[model samples]
Structures are given as structure tokens and as C-alpha cells.
Target: MHRSLCLAALLSLAASSALASGFPVTVRSCDRDVTFEAAPKRAVSQDINLTEMMLALDLTGQMAGYSGISGWYKMDDELKARLGDLPELAPQQPTKEVLLGADADFLFAGWNYGMKVGGEVTPDTLEPFGIKVYALTESCIHIMKKDKSSMEDMYTDIVNLGRIFGVEEKALALVDGYKAEIAKAIAAVPADAPVPKVFVYDSGEDKPFTAGRYAMPTALIEAAGGKNIMDDVETSWTTVGWEGVIERNPDVVVIVDYGDVTAEQKADFMRKNPAFKDIPAVKNNRFVVLPYAQATPGPRNVEAVKTLAGAFHPTVN
Candidate 1:
């Protein structure tokens, strides 16, 4: 009986160690402990960017619910079909009752802005109800009070998600492919050649919203071998006067293409604006329309870089 008791005690110790090994590590944005109960069999993604990452990681089978549909970055038809059975959580700011009632084991979201700034659901708010939350690193910067964001940080986010979902090997493979493509594109550009000045016109038709220094679009412009004309602007989003755009005369105008607005419509809108008609890009028809997903800093950003590189240097082949 003594020997049996000793064996049982040893077994219990080993079990505790194993459980400790499986406990989720605290991430950058939130204060709460994010340990998963059992790898989240039923998960709900609060943001479309998070949903996209799950799809990329091939963890869509575990997805129990999602927010945002039929927008610029709509899920694939097959994925959309699966979502019909899942609960509909609002993309912008889902209520606590709505989130809790979904009965999800885990909640995945891109940023804390919706929960933190809006006074909606939070890490502490969800923990009591038995839900674990994971915030993507791309959106963490918004909550962090950091002055600068980086491309390396974006790559780290992909690898981190891959680690969480047990798809590190696949994530590395994807990263390898992306690196190869970017290197090839970069090699073709001449070092002495001048980088074209670019203006990223993201959404907001009323004020002509433009990408400032801190925004993801500016990072993408630099990565794609172009110069952001408004890199001097410190804020993320700024309303520039039409006279300013005409004076800058950027070589390439990148319009954030939404599902509701077509590329031609955007071009026409710019052409009609009296202050923009004389700009070289508008006059010469050098307009590149970037989708909403590509413009944002997330897993798809590398693809956005590729698109921009192709647009800027068409002769690269």
C-alpha cells in the first residue's frame, strides 16, 4: 500500500507538469491569462483579418463562428457555406451577450481596439464566462502606444499564429514562398533608378482620406519600391487638401478598392475632383486599386506588396 501511494503521487506530479506545459503564454496586448481549455474545438473569430489567418492556417474546420461577410475581403464560397450554421457576431463591436451566447470555447480577434476603446468585450470580461481570447500581433500595435510598426512584426504574427494552431511547418512553407517571390521582385529593380512617389487614397470619399506615416499602407509603399508622398504626415489617417495632392504630383495613386466601389468609379471620382485633375498619375492613368484586405497590415500584406511591385515595375517580368 505504501508503494502504491508513492506511485500515485509521482503520476499526479507528472500530470501537473504536462498541464503546465500546455498552458497558453500571455501575449503582448492583453493582461489576462489566455490558457486554452483543450485546443479550442469550437472557436469564433471576431474580425475578418483573424478569420483570414485561420483560413490560411487551414484551421477553418475548428471555426464555430465568424463576424463580417459579403464585404471587400469576403471568405471563399466554400467557407461562407460552412458559416451559415455558425452564429453571426457583429464585426465592428459585438455585444457581450452576443459573444457569450455563441458558446465558443475560444475567441480570436485581430485587434483590441473594438474591445478596449469601445468598452465592449474584453479579456477580463470573457474569462469569467469560460472563454479564452487571443489578439493578433498586427492589431496589438494599436493598443500598445508604439510609435512605429514593422514588416518583420507582420512576419512574426504569421509564425506566431502558425505555432498556436499547430501549423508551424505550413506557415514556414508559406513564408519561404513569399520571401522567394519578394527577393526575385526586389532583384529586378535597379538600385540607381528613382523610386516612384505614391499616394495611397484609402476610403472616405467626403474628405479624400490619405495614408499617413504610421499606417500600414505607408509600410507597403516603401516595401514595394515606391515613396509615400505623405510620409511626413505623423497620423495614421489624414485629410489632405486637393491642392496638396496636385502639388505633390505622385507617379502612382493607390486607391483602396472596396466591394461597393469599382476601380473606374474611384478613378472618375478623382478625375472629377478639381484639385486632382492635373496630377501626373490621374492624367497619365497610372492608378492601382488595392483591395481592403491587402491594404491592412495582416497575413495578406505580403501579397499586397507583390501586387504593388508588379504595378510599379511592370517590365520586371
Candidate 2:
């Protein structure tokens, strides 16, 4: 009887061990490959979009907190609810002190989002502090020579995050869902539908700040059956002369709603400006407002693409 009881205990222990997570998983981040011995217990994600990536993975339990969200971007009710009780460590960008103080084991940041090139808070600087930084794939253009941004870049980040957190199934499922949802949404547009020429109006009175081919919006616009007017600019995000805007003559202007200025205000500015009077988008009063979170790469991109598709093909859906 004693031997049987001991054998049963050993079997139970072995079963538990078998079910344990496989550690030391290696994931590619930008040009470097990183290995994680175990899932991060305390991770800090930077920016609203990056934080949403972590949240979409149901990784709130692993997060220490988030940074660079509430600073420039307005938090939506849905996002706020998902991040309940999670502290906003930094209003803008995080300092090395903040990560070290939180005892953060990992950081999810990008080039322009959180860590700038040679900036104070970068992957190299944070490495010595025991904080492993996962670079946002879209922002890799700052450091590495890469192809133009694609929806696949976002999917890659989601899958890699899942692998790092031991939730591969959930990540892949979410990506599949996004792809299906986008396909269904754009199905309303006819195959021979004219591809609308779109312009992304972020901000700037002197020169318009817009996204180029390297930015996520290029892919989003393409997925929505529209072409970005600035796709040939070779920049991710930069200012362009109004002459270029007049020359391109975008059919629809996608307004990014964020900061102090309202989307309506931006539209009003475009309509009032004499220089933009002849522009197709402004002349026709065709404008679609996309929330900042939705415009950038993250979970909200699928919905953003749907919004653009509906706007670009007005009669389709």
C-alpha cells in the first residue's frame, strides 16, 4: 500500500512537469535574436499601440505597467477598461530610472515611439539594467535597412509576443481573426473598383506631416483598396511641401485624431485653406477620421482599414 501511494505521487509530479512551459524561447527582434529563459514576470510596454499589443495577448498579469500612452494620445473607453488598475508609469517617454525602479524584466518599445536612435532610453542602454527590449517591427526602419511596412509586420510582432509569453495559440488566432475580418469588410468593394488616392493628414500648418511607404498606413491603405499619395516619399513619417499635396490631389483625406487639435478642426483647416481649394479631397469634402490608436500599428488596425474602405468606396458599403 505504501509503495502504491509513493508511485501515484511520482506520476502526478511527472505529469505536472510535462505540462510546464518550454523556456529559453528565442525570438527575432529587428536584427538581433533574443532568448527568454522564462516568461517575463514584470513587463513594461511603451506607447498606446504597443501596450494594446500586450493587452490583446491578455498579458496584463505579466505587465508591471505602461509608459508613453497618456502623454500624446487620448485613451479610449475600451482601451481604458482593458487597462484597468494598470499604472501609467510615464506620461511621455520612460527613463532608465523608471524601469529599474519597477524591476521590469522586459520592455516593448519602438524607435520613434519610446526609444529613439541613440536616445537615453534605448535597447542597448536598458540591456545592462536587465530589461530586455522588444523593438516594434514597424519602427525597425530607423536602425535596419528593411522592406516597406506590411500588415505581416504587425502579425509578426503579435506572434513573437505570444511565443515570448507562452501564448502562441492565442496570438495566431487573433491574427487569423484580423485577416478574416479585414477580408470580409473589404468584400463590399468591387474587384474592379477604382483605387482611391488617399492622403493621411497628421498635423502641421507650414508643411503637412504624412506617412510614407515605410509606415503601417501604406499597408492599411493598400488593404482597403486605396493608394497612399505619399507612398513614394521613402520616409516613414515626415513633412512634405503643399506643392506635393496639390500635385498628388488625393481623393480622400484620412485625418488622424489625436493631440489637442480635433479631427474636425483639421478638416476645417483643409477646407478653408485656399491652397487646398482645388484638392480633390477638400473640394469634395471627403474626409475620414481615424483615431490615433487605429492609425498606428496595433490591434485597432483591422477596424481602421474597414473604415478607410467604406470611405474610399462611398457607394460600396
Candidate 3:
């Protein structure tokens, strides 16, 4: 009986060793001990941002499902044509049944909130089914122990995603090109010129939702030769009273159009708002509308900066 017990323990150890050796190591946002079996053949992306990054890296062929294509930021025509047949993975938080029924080899996502809120899918949740998950570094709330984040973090996320997809070379090339363009644009702006005071009007309905210091809107403002009027506000977003806008009286008001809101509606809102109309931006008609995708820190945010610079300094043209 003693010999049989020892033999069984030895067999178990060997089996554990074999399993460990067979699985591939994949580091993600939360912690690193994730393991997978070779490259995933079928992938499900929960956010459009991750989907776009995968497509940029030429890994869209591996995608079995995705979410958030119809709202906010829609996929480009070429991608739509190519991926017309794949299943829609539901908006925001998809059901567990849908996620599991897809039989995806792996799951990639930009926002953890989706899972935390209602998706009911977590790393441990998928582990029993032999599914692996990776979170975008940009969307990671904790990393390097920083409260606020920057555009460099987005670049790092893109590169990390590239590494996971085995397309590091392509990702690096894209990052390098974007950085070069941004650097060129920054150089064109004279250092001595005063930065324009800008307000990022993210949403304006009953109460305006504006970007504060802790987000990409602030970074975009700095990049565009402007100072975010809300730079002193420590939070990522804030709902402000019309009196607050009157007090700030910004030089430029950048309206963040989510495409869900039309330019006409935004213009009407600005003109009709009793408190905002008297502001310099509204009075002088220096309102600039930026797309929601461009305003957010991602692979395309630098382009948004260029657009802003051109709008702010049209005389340079």
C-alpha cells in the first residue's frame, strides 16, 4: 500500500509538470501567471478599440466575435466588408452564454469594466474551460502605481498587444510613424507662444460633462498648443454647472462628437446655452468638433492632435 501511494504521487507530479511545460505564458494587465496552448486560433474581442488594434496588426482573421461596432466608433468600410460574417458579441457586457457558446480560444478586451459590471467573465471564470484572457494595458487602472495616465501608456498597450499577437514588428512600425508625426507637429509650434486655454466639452445636455486633468483630453490639449481649462480639476470627468463654464470663459471649446451626436445638435447646444454663449469661444466662434475616438488616447490620438493644431493655427497653413 505504501509503494502504491508513492507511485500515485509521482504520477501526479509528472502530469502537472507536463501541463506546465505544454502551456504558453501570457502576461496581461492584472497579473502574469497566465498560460495558454500555442497561439489562439479563435479570438473574441470585447471592445472596438482592441478589435481595431488587432486589425491593425493583421490578426483580424483570428477574431471569432467582437462588441461595440455599431455605436461610438464604427469599424471602417474595409473591415466591415471583411468581417461582415462574424457574430456580434453584444454591446458593452455580453452574456456568459454568448461568450462561452462562441467557443473562442482566447478573449481580448480594452475595458475590464465590461466584465466587472455585467459580463460575468473573468480570468478564473474562463480558466476552467481552457480559455485565456488579456486586458489592454491602456485600460489597466493599476500599473507602475500611477493615479493618472498618459499617451505613452497607449503606445505601450499597442506594443504589448502586438507582442501577444506575434506582430511586434508591425506594431513598432506603426508606433514609430505616429510618434514621428506627433513630434513634427509639436516642433512646428513655437515654444514661446502662450498655450491657448481650451475646454473639452465631452457632452453637453442638461449638465455638461467635461474632461478633467486625469485623462487623454488633458494630454490632447497640451499636445495641441493649448492648456486644458479643467487641468486643475483632478478627476477624469466632471459634470459642471453653466456658471462654471462662465467663470472659466475658455478661448477654444472643443466639442467631443461621439458620432451619436450630430455637429448641428452640438452647434445648437452651444448657441442656445444661456451661460456658454457669452464665453469667448462661443462669442468668437472658435469651437472645434473632434470625434470621440480621436479624442481618446489610442493609436489614432496623435492624428487628433494634428487636427487640433491645424484648427488652432490655420495661419501656419
Best candidate per TM-score, number? 2
Among these predicted structures, which one has the highest lDDT? 2
Structural similarity to truth (TM-score) of each candidate: 0.82, 0.93, 0.80
- How well is each residue in 1-317 modelled by candidate 3, as lDDT tens digits? 69999999999997787555543436556445455446577788765556766666777777778876664555567658756687777765655677678887778764443455234677667778877777655445422234454667668767766666666678899899888998888788777766678888887678788887666777877877888888777655568776777788888888887657776688678878776767888888888887666766565688788888877776544
lDDT of each: 0.69, 0.90, 0.70
Per-residue C-alpha lDDT of model 2 across residues 181-286, encoded as one tens digit per residue: 9889788889999998999999988898999988988989999999999999886878899899889999999998999899999999999999999998998999
The alpha-carbon RMSD values of the candidates against the true structure, listed in the order shown, are 3.5, 3.7, 5.4
Ranking by lDDT: 2, 3, 1
What's the lDDT of the predicted structure labeled candidate 3? 0.70
Clashing pairs in 2: none
Query: Of 2 and 3, which scores higher on lDDT?
Result: 2
1 or 2, which is superior by TM-score? 2
Clash pairs, model 1 backbone: none
Candidate 1 ranges beyond 4 A from true positions: 1-24, 30-38, 71-88, 112-116, 237-243
Runs in model 3 deviating more than 4 A are 1-37, 71-79, 82-84, 117-119, 142-147
